[model samples]
Target: MPQYSIKDHLYESQLFINRSIAAAIIVTLMLLLLGVRMVYLQVVSHEHYTTLSKDNRVKLQPLPPTRGLIYDRNGVILAQNLPAYSLEITPEKVESLEQTIEQLALILPISEEDRRRFKKLRRQRRPLRQYPDPSTPER
Candidate 1:
């Protein structure tokens, strides 16, 4: 004959219930911690992050300084900066190049040499073309 011991049904049920309650409490605590961390980042640290973002978005560029004059050993001028005025014409914008030049000549002094150079450049290139007005005397 084989002998078997009786199982304690009430104790087993209480143990299972306790374990379920412990797991639920742990999960609830983890969710509460996550919510608090999210609130702190969005509200408390808002200004610091905003300033950092603005600093990243804006950029600063340095302008180059004007070049100085250069001279040879004999004191002869090798290179020097001269202020000169120039005229730029876009072929596409003007209805007639000859007419526009004639109109400009009436308003400003356009020499024969300037007119000749303008015609030569107009033939060689397209789009915006610039030429110096030699009417200004050399410095």
Candidate 2:
């Protein structure tokens, strides 16, 4: 036969109740802190966040920077953008660029080498794509 002392103790109920109260108090404190932080963001730090949000939404540009004159020790212009004329004609503006090139050849001494170089530069500036004119039949 096994003998039992059977001392369950009366403090077990009090210990469980104390632990439950502590847990509830900790949870309530965490929720209180969260609520306080939310209120602080909405009311106290409102303008700061509003300015940042506005800065993202609005695009504010600065004035164009001025180009200054640069000179060397020997009074020579190191760099400058002086008034210069260039024969710039849009490729799309010209109906037949071959005829245009022939006309320009009459005025300027543009060699076959120069025409090849110009075509190379044009290819770099604009992508090569065949645009078939509906008015003229494709050759």
Best by lDDT: 1
TM-score of every candidate relative to the true structure: 0.42, 0.40
Residue-wise lDDT of candidate 1 within 6-48, one digit each (tens)? 9999999999999999999999999999999888888999998
Best by TM-score: 1
Model 1 clashing residue pairs (backbone): none
- Alpha-carbon RMSD, each predicted model: 12.8, 15.9
- Candidate 2, residues 27-57, lDDT tens digits: the string is 9999999999999999999999999998996
Taking the candidates one at a time, how many backbone clashes does each contain? 0, 0
Clashes counted in candidate 2 amount to: 0
Stretches of candidate 2 exceeding 4 Å from the true structure: 1-9, 60-139
